[model samples]
Target: MSAANSPDFPMFVSVAEARQMLAALLPALETEWVGVGQGYGRTLAQPLAALVSHPSATESALDGIACRAADTLGASASAPAHLQLTGESRAGVPFAGEVGPGQCIRIYTGAPMPAGADAIAPVEQLIDDGPDAVLVQRPASPADVRPEGGDFRAGEEVMPAGLRLTAPRLALAAALGHARLPVRRRLRVALLSTGDEVIEPGQPLLPGQVYDSNRIGLSAMLEECGCEVLPLGHAADSPGALQAAIDSIGGADLLLTSGGVSMGKYDFMRDLLIVQGRVSFWKVRMRPGGPALLGGWNGLPVFGLPGNPVSSLVVFHVIVRPALTGQPVQTLRLRAGTAFRGLPDKVAFWRANIVGGEVHDYGKQGSGVLRSLSEAGALVVVPEGGSVAAGDEVDVVLL
Candidate 1:
């Protein structure tokens, strides 16, 4: 008999236990090289090192004049030092001549420092007495100029492998002269929904029928995690139908099926997994989507999510999404906008939004209500048997 169907295994495991069990089984996706411009949201597979030193030469940081620090010494607002303006240095246009004693070079932002100049004085700090000469009232510090390799040196490791490329990170790669970056290939996840009552959207609805909302919702969630979704559509709640649906997804790295995992008479996923595959865990002791199943089928990892739209998304954010992105979801603590009371046995994920740093839950916390997930920007996690009174601190997971 399979472990899921055996009497020894718990019918429901804690969320932590379920995640820990699956983490050991899920394999890492392969890597590929992609254009750096298109790498946002993708995880890097190789460490990126600097190709050339930034600010290859010492340059000016201000749009003013470059001169010897000694030239401006001992000058004050009342007694100013005057220096002859020899030449000017515009950005990308270097002055061919060097500065000599009692001379300064007019320079703009990012302009290379002249051969003899070691400091820059801002235009506001000096009086421009025509183009021939300038007056500086105070001494310029050597720190006024950016030194060579001020940002990074050649061959220095700037970005490490496994980092999810964000806008700023991509810019860093571009600045390092990498036209392409090595990134992990997107995970392929198959999506399927089970239940006779579930009908396709735009189809005529019968008395007991509802649109297949999970397919679209789950697809979006999987896509957001950079997974290539192989949507297998819907299947009836039956042994044969479930098997056929599973067979349709040929090469998915992960299979995600919504509904049919609970103990209802029509819920066939839990029982079928026990008979045809190896179920890592049958249920998770969490609210809004507690009837979750994780398993392996024909060597492919499978996630059986609850049928309710909101529940599926919550569980995805807490579990599946993190596994795909290879990053832990972000969480914060904020003041509760209202009191929350729940059962002592199950942890609750309350749909919520942060307004002025306060956590406010949605009007309806039901699993089937997609509106709750739509209007919420975060999930307020209420620990088992925990009560959060108004104005109390509660932990939140950002969506």
Candidate 2:
């Protein structure tokens, strides 16, 4: 369907359609080698394989005496085994002598097993008689040993590409001897806030002037998605100012603007985008953010959100962020008691707080109130023309 006449135009692109558009428009960028410690939260650009064999050689897994399993099998708890302690082996140190029958070596955790050693009797299971000798209280078996390459063999694939490098994953890479990893380069995004009434925060409020919360909020959200946020500041309601702001942000991977995309007389963002870019869609069938714009400006994805505070955030989380991250969009069904009566035909996203397993709608559902959104844990999505009763389930998009 065409962008203008399509049933689900601009705002409410179907989940599949949105994902396909994102994939067709954006391609994975170049990769860079970063240290494993700095890889957390970044997606891997290439598969991370072991640089060398983990452990590099056979090693001990515990502090105890290392000996051949056959040497200790005959002895039992009733009649303890006796073996001469040849030498001590510590972590990162290798035993110099081979362990033969009736011979054992005192080994600590992580120490490499000596040649001919097949099992380890934990220190707790043995009694120390003197510095050179230790007595085993019970017979050890082959199961008591950690053989070579038991954890990981050489040239084994550890972590594959496209994986988000979390803390535990980074640690595993480090343990696998990966000092550096390949990660995707960060996407650069340009942000613009539109409207004559909006003023920068901390500035004295003149008549008809409101603080420019959208710019600040949208910038933080872009950065949270791992983008390099370039704040282009506020654009006046005039088309000249909007066009100037659009031209100034050159070579950005994505352009995000708030306000002036709706059907209002002062709305100029859609016109500006049509002139400089392709306007894919102008409006969506959704509440709180129905007047949204999606297009490509100068070969960069551009998203135009509503001027209201809550509406801007809702669209940002629902559409913009997921498009940038290439993450699949998921619709969650709200727990019982989240439905509202008299919901309209358009999909409505309202701020709600989850307490005691129930979602209570926050007061002041107006898009202008940022405080309501700040206190909300989720966005309760009411489908078109659907009315919900107490304890009825509804779809929710978690913020």
Candidate 3:
């Protein structure tokens, strides 16, 4: 028997242990090629290499006079070295002639370097001695020249596989002359929020009714994780309703259901998964998100999330996100701006606002408090039995 079911261990598991189980059971997603312009937010399936060297040849980095460094050796305002200007080079146009002794060529930014020239005398430092000749106020150095293939070389690896594409990555791919990028196809996730009290946002609210916020909120989160969301609507706290809803999830890669996973009498999803689903209920040792279960239903992976607004999103961020996106949870150490209570038995992930490198709690750290998660903008991590005094260092994960 698993430790989660052991009489000594009770009904919960450590976050570390749960993640191990999840990693071993999760399936790899499929991949496809997409236009480089449309590759934002997608994970790369293969490594990308630069097709051609940037600045394929030696070019000018500024609009200046290109002359041999030896020719500008004693050139200054009082005793300026004069050189004959052979021709002007700008962008695609290049001065085909070589810059001989006592001669210079006009070069613009990104223009190829003329033959026999190694230094650049910027226009601002030149005496403008007419179109045929110019006076140098200062000596030019070779540092002013932009060497060939300066930014990157051809055949060099630009990006490795499994990297999530961003705006900058897309720009790099386009600059590298790539037309398409091989990326993982967005996973199709089916979501259902369960509870008789939950109703759609537009509907009129009764005395005990709550708006159906999880369905829409979770969908947006899944999209940010690069998944394709399939909204299955909401279900009541009934076996038949949830069963029919699960049966209707056709072609979805994963299943997510909020509510009905706790130990309450109306927790039909917990009882249904125990009876029919391949995976059983397993709580995590964390406040607000301690009520979470994972397993498979009809060969489909299922994540049963808590109903409370903050709790539901916390579970998604700490667990379901990594399973779907293949990204590990990353946190940083920040000083606590104020005192935060500690849980003796479970780890506390407090919704706290970060200011000037310190973490501060955003109102009460309750499961049902949605504003805390919104206003805080980050989750401060306090380990089991570890309380934070003011200015104490704590781990935090920005949302």
Candidate 4:
């Protein structure tokens, strides 16, 4: 058989082509330093380091008397020796004078320890505490005191660039005295749906018509990827309508459309691209979403997806998402519990559910079956000319 007639035909492009296509399309936007509390899901633009030494200075970790550990080593509860209290120290305050021998400073938690003090004797372990002197109830150790820079060092790198500032990470940055964080600009994506037979959800569906779902679904997924979605709404199934919608989204970095790309009579998306932009490729050797479209419009990337709900979703995840995020495509292999009688020349993606570690294939694996796509946890990827027995291993692409 010729290459085209082979059961496992390959349509491959160089990895460099894929990477360059992504880079040429997704140019990084200007960075902004947003408040740390509002920086969730944003990629960090610069590394964050501690502004000052943690603890800032020597401090006490407990409400106690600051004293030299050696002086209190032999003092016991039963027969305690007295030490004069020079003064009291609270949080954010430092003892004004140094502690001398036979003298201690009253210190609270987080207070800077007075000079000449090596440890803290907790309040419960002290007796007859007055401003002048106090008696020891139990001996204390050096471990009771928290020294300067105990938790973190000065000028230490806390979080590096490219970090997605989550809630806890923001709090940590705030604790390190970072009021604002530099983060990558959000990606702007334009969403459009095309079809005369499709109507918006909640609108009355006439005979031979269905609700338009791709726009809502794709917008949600794009937002989850941190993209600022500019929804251009639905475009009618006509060359003029498609061109008008494309023109309206001229400012977007990426343009994503559902439907009107297949080799059908009313496939205006391809014709619109031929007229307005460079059409790189019209189709891929994949099932469900084989009739995919990749092109550029006014120097921006445009992906024309199949109108069928499952096909649109599959192509979006497997091809479009990775292309937009500049990430590598991942694949997996597993057992195909569903029987395949014969293998075809094209790779197929079947809706499947994993039950008890076994893949159970769903019936009616049609491109328009949005219900099946919603129910499926993964797509069983059957390579060209591949077949599977009940317990045989198969490749799967997790949705």
Best by TM-score: 3
- lDDT, candidate 4, 118-229, per-residue tens: 8889998898756588997767668877877776776999888866667788877887888888888888999999999989889877899988888889999897667889
Poorest 10 consecutive residues of model 2 by lDDT? 1-10
Error of 4 at 185 (Å): 1.7
lDDT of each: 0.85, 0.77, 0.85, 0.77
Clashing pairs in 4: 334-394
Q: How many backbone clashes does candidate 4 have?
A: 1
Q: What is the C-alpha RMSD of each candidate to the true structure, in Å?
A: 3.0, 4.7, 3.0, 6.7
Candidate 2: how many backbone clashes? 3
Q: Candidate 4, after superposition: displacement of residue 364 in Å?
A: 4.7
lDDT of 1 at 277: 83
Q: Residue-wise lDDT of candidate 3 within 271-328, one digit each (tens)?
A: 7877677664468888878988877888888888999988999888987888777888
lDDT of 2 by residue, 21-87 (tens): 6556665678988888888777788887776776666767778889887777756566678888889
After superposing candidate 2, which stretches have Cα over 4 Å from the reference?
A: 1-12, 32-41, 63-84, 100-104, 116-127, 135-151, 174-180, 206-209, 274-277, 330-366, 369-399
Taking all chains together, the TM-score of candidate 3 against the true structure is: 0.90
Predict model 1's lDDT versus the native: 0.85
Better of 2 and 3 by lDDT: 3
RMSD of 3: 3.0
